[model samples]
Target: MWNKLFVDHPRTVQESYGEHAVMAASFGGRMVLAGLACLVHAVVPGLFVRTGSRTITVLYDEMVVNRNRKANKAAGEVAAVGGR
Candidate 1:
């Protein structure tokens, strides 16, 4: 149960438990801030017009692009070691 709760997803993501926790918290914090900005922009319609979308795009790139790079690197390293 402990492994299921803490270890499995992080391993799939190539992060340790603590690293995953910290990263998840950071993503949540950023999303909350972006949501607040979106709320304000809905009423003001001029301020922070780009903040929410920009944040989402940046986060998506970070999560998808960077993670794929990491996974590919890891796979390459494993293949090299196995070939050796």
Candidate 2:
């Protein structure tokens, strides 16, 4: 199932650099590394799923109020500075 999600592509720009065996090899390596990263990203979410009802709603609401207060203070300070 997971194998179908990963689609690999070759590095085409490297081929234009030089007509040499080493360049092609490095291009292939880059493609492999990119493919590996994509595969890891796809599978990682399933592996690290936090299974539970989130109970931080009140805390988040408090944080929003705190953030608003701080923003208002900063804006007031900016206005005072500009006024002077």
Best by lDDT: 1
Give the residue spans of candidate 2 off by over 4 A.
1-55
Q: What's the residue-level lDDT of 60 in candidate 2? A: 48
lDDT of each: 0.94, 0.49
Candidate whose TM-score is highest = 1
What is candidate 1's lDDT per residue for 1-84, written digit by digit as tens? 999998999999899999899989999999999999999999999999899999999999889986998799999999999999
The all-Cα superposition gives candidate 2 an RMSD in Å to the true structure of: 18.7
Runs off by more than 4 Å, candidate 1? none
**Model 2 local distance difference test score:** 0.49
Write candidate 2's Cα lDDT for 18-75 as tens digits. 3434544654665565556556656785631332112133334644675587678778
- The 10 consecutive residues of candidate 1 with the worst lDDT sum are 61-70
